[model samples]
Target: MKACLILLLLAAVLPVSAQQLPVDAVKGDYIVGALQLPEAGVLELQSPDGQLLRRQAAPAGESEFRFVALQSGRYRAGLASPQSQGRVWLTEQRPLEAQLPEVAAPEAPLASPKLRALANELGAGTPAFWAAVQASGAPWIEPIPDHPQSWQVSFLWRGDASTRSVRLFWPVRQGDQERFARLPGTDVWHYSVRLPSGTRLAYQLAPDVPQLKGAGRQAQRRAILARVQADPLNLRRWAAGTPALGGFDNIQAEHSLLELPGAPPEPWLEPRAEVPRGRVEHLRFQSQQLGNERRLTVYLPAQKSAEALPLLLLFDEDAYVTRVPTTTILDNLIASGRIPPLMAVLVGNPTRESRSEELPCNPRFADMMAGELLPWLAARYPVTREAGRTVVAGSSYGGLASAWLALRHPERFGRVLSLSGSFWWAPARPPGFVAGGLDDAAEGEWLTRQYVAAPRSDVVFYLSPGLLERSAPSDGPGILETNRHLRDVLMARGQRVIYREFAGGHDYVNWRSELAEGLIALLGAP
Candidate 1:
């Protein structure tokens, strides 16, 4: 009788402070929270991984919750009796500027006592429960904070038979291994990992059994087909589906795109009604060197064509046109006279394997661009043949190819815009394979030594590195390190090198800005 009276007294007094707390919080900041409850109850705090960290009793009123986060990540705080919860981010310490709200109660259950009871079991404030709900009956990835420089991406999958493990096709993971955690008492799987800011990554999730490792390509692909899925929770997707490659069929294989915070703004990516737009011509022709037909996207500036207009050959043509907003950028740059009126030919790769095969320091690819593609473009368009007026540009592997083209055929492509170039490539070592391991001097130092051994002139190079590009598998030395090494080598060889670094990852999101900067620096009118 005394306990029931106390509970009634507490419930009446707890509902008075019905204010919502500030959602944003940093590590080590004290949070003064409020919970209107029928009685005093225990509040539980959980880590990002769902590990119970602390539990303490709170009175039915405004209460002080002190926190000191040792690391930067996401955390969950909730109370038991009324069952209310909230999310907190522990980054750099900052003052709380918002008011706390009354603790919320669990939703009244309708049917499915099992699910309802489970929902009550896992606090509504818990990331685990929220992740499962957002997945909408499919695998999901929910980033803790919408805009985070370093993100803790939570992966969720509901349990089912025939699946042993879920694997991620991400580069930074250790040994491309599968790591998943199952939720207690629920048919749900989860895993979380931290990634740097502005990382534009395309990845797929696959359910695999150990037996599939030794299976044939067709068999493995069949198994993969049953399991591989784009993150259901992540709304952003890669612009296009990656075509088939290396006999493994996934004709419509689409990967999910995760764009971390701090991507450099490419103002030209959006079409501005005020800015004059350029013309895009889609052209296709047979390539004698590659033994296949290829597609081209040519951007013609708004300015009237000249008898000898400078030309820029951009690899990964489709991506630049659709993803980078190339035409819009050209229109703006040409209108403002930041760069001279020039023609740009975007060359598309037929397949992922073909792109990888051709874009890396390949002599045949260089020959194809200089001997076949250039002449074909010049025949139809009034473009300059002078090397000084010609530019070869690309990002990542294409960046490596751009530098290789200028070095091999300076008479054709005299200017190179290499954004996050794979300078770690070498004649002896295949990309990403550590033959004898990291001790091999040829890792990222390959291309830099080539320039040291046989220096070339008449080529003006624009080298840009993303600050967040710390490592890549095939390149050995990673993205940023390789670009820096190449820059140092170019400077030492007395080459005219324009080197710059931007705040981003080794992604197109970062390269878009570098592309604009490089063009203006190399082709800008005085």
Candidate 2:
């Protein structure tokens, strides 16, 4: 029993008129209770330990008091004069409300001409309309006659009386959920998007998602995951029984695959029967500079050469090895002579915390890579010592670290292949520094400014960021914007740069294909 409850029981000798109202609330809930007091008195809010938290003045007769439960715990409100008491239990559940967007009526102007014509002819949300959609399959894709490079993709959902809203969950721009508008007097809910012809991604659909009112916007938006599932109408999916190319296990957690006609083919992802396979050796490497140990995976090419082989160092070892099929890609590239036979070192992080600490332009991490890691590899393998033959590559923060390493020690890493590099990162600011507030002048794009100030180095860069990675207003510049800025800065300084933007997001699926392209661009056989 709580100390507050013990105190309340001990004070039972005082005359009580009416029972106090008990409250069951969620965290962030506004809790209100009424006390039947004979005369005006003070109500004290106490913690579980019987310590007074706050006091509120209660009027005579029926007195009311309110409290905002910011955290999950048991609290007590008691009137000292009448000895009436109330208990409140606050849970961790987020307070949710209905925040659904108003749906467009059937008579409203539909974005797609097909949807408009269908609505006018057969009336949307009817049995006939659903039959037609089922026959044609979803999401209904149509070619834009005027714009050959783009396609109109419409997502559809069938809802019942209980369904409040629907959302499309995809690797969309900055990971925003797309809302579906319901048709009046019908079960049909639809959302249409114009995507590039080369768009390839996986998506899920959430129906009747709970809208959190008291939580942050991101928390409310993520509530869709409770009801998110693969689109039933979408025939293609990324799940079990599919080729082992970095996919999911079960259908419940699966996502529907969306590959447009013009999407680039992922040729090197699968292991080929004809191609010679490379050997992957896993070893635990202890770093003296960072005072930690991590796993390092080395890939030895199938074909052995007399001279020292070119070296490729990649960050996020498990991801590149498993999700990306990096060794298979290397085998295909080497066997086809698209790129020369080279050894690759996939570096793993000791922990998630260490990765966040070290990979964001940390000089100690750069020192460890150049001084300790590379020398250790050189002693074990016949890897090239020349900088031109050495390439450092990664995605996201790993990408940022790759650029930073190359920039700091150009003689160690001559080429940097950064996919979706986070150039928006700056040095750690003092506590309580808002992201884009008044003190934001020296905040973002730290690495970009460093390249501008530092002397020109003999380094080449292959940088790529997804077009969908545009930053929100509050986040300063995002990966796409910051990467473009970095590219421009490098080119202005007469540095060799090969930059490209794909119609995708910050996803591993896109990075897998881009990795092969980057390797072929930088180290392809001449």
Candidate 3:
């Protein structure tokens, strides 16, 4: 009783403010708050990366602020005062309150003519009209009711009338095609189309065709391709530095991702209070084959035991560690007993060229892993050496490498997790083509054909691809179709495979959850 009282007294005397600010909000809505400052001061809204999105000065006593049309992500709203710091989440639209000084008198600001005109056009007070208008562009993705197969995608082309029209360069079932759409209103242009469930797609906005600058027609086309950009408003973006993985040649390009209804939910993606977290040890690995050092981020379970644990080998270690919350996911899974205590070795590629060369069915790379890396890891850590207990996994080209490694040395890697594997790779193509090139060989399932012809291994396979993915070339089908073909071939050959179609493009945003699922399915016990 004495200790409880002392704690209560300490809490009461602590300098930290007891009041919590409102944090939850919907992606498409507004969050209104008032901050009481030193008379009048500057308030700033910042992105998670500290980019200043908006800054305004208001009279000190009490000033009102509204975070309007926020994307689905976390943001920080702050002033110069240390006590006023607060975080907000836009995914779960909830009410929030600010800890500001009491207002003396509230002032109603005059509405702009554009807003007033918009209100008049949509019958100001009608909720449905307001909601529809609010969702009219690219970052604002909404499902159209009564048409279960269709979704409305909006893009705001804020450029002048001379901008011609905006086009979405995306893949469709009939073949890769560019759909040109006009702006219905002042700035927003929208497109509604039917897509299969559980489709993940990445797209860019091609607005304003540029004039050819001292180049031929081909150069002009290349320039136009370079101008394609990810949706500015869509915060759920793909990882950088792995361009051409999505079939685009522009290294500077960023593609926006979209998840249709069927995408699997990864509840373990977030940290849970009751779940015990794991320890991540970073190490530098010197590869004899590559003749350079690479980084490896390893995840070890919270509860260590004398028994060796199954090992999960991942490619693009840096992205998994920084972008996807792999450790958190593992913690939740292990805590809930959904998966056994396992070790994850995320091996990073030294360079873009090296990653492409090594990961895509490179026998020399496979030989190095079998001869050097795996043995080194096994000797150092309490890891299972049984082929069935060792899992090799990766995304895109890395994914191709995982399967190839498993197929070549089934005695070492008995399980394979291929997320959007590049089964379309052909030996006839150039080195750069390994990133995005699809060939006529075996209808874009070249590797799958090779696997079918060869003797089947006892390895288990998990293949995941986005449904919205179309065939890369105009002559062939997209990655999704190729993956399905691979699945069929693998199954027909009597190889065990788990095939799933997620509502995502060829990006980690979708693969992160699939990775979790693959681990649980392969290594977890009921």
Reference-based TM-score of each model: 0.61, 0.74, 0.66
Candidate 3 Cα misplacement greater than 4 A, ranges:
1-132, 135-147, 152-156, 162-180, 184-188, 198-263, 429-443, 472-475
lDDT of 1: 0.61
Tens digits of lDDT, candidate 3, 337-373: 8888999998876643466667777677888888889
Instruction: Report, for every candidate in turn, its global Cα lDDT versus the true structure.
Output: 0.61, 0.73, 0.63
RMSD of each: 22.1, 14.7, 17.2
Q: On a 0 to 100 scale, what is the lDDT of residue 135 in model 2?
A: 79
Q: Please give, for residues 1-526, the per-residue lDDT of candidate 2 as tens digits.
A: 3533433443452233234323334444444444544333456666545566555543333433445443456666665545544322222222322233324323223567887788778878788887887877788778998999999998888888866678887765544567787776678888888888888777888775654434486555545544567898888886412111111111124578887878888998888999999998988899987788888889999998998999999997756765577899999999999999999999876653466667778887888999999999999999999999999999988899899999889999999999998798886654222221113554888889999999999899999998777876666788899999999999999999999888787667788899999999999965
Error of 1 at 141 (Å): 12
Give the residue spans of candidate 2 off by over 4 A: 1-109, 119-122, 239-252, 430-442
> Candidate 2 at residue 356, lDDT?
62
Instruction: Write candidate 1's Cα lDDT for 213-249 as tens digits.
Output: 2236444333333235566666667543222222222
Candidate 2, residue 216: the lDDT equals 81
Rank order (by lDDT, best first): 2, 3, 1
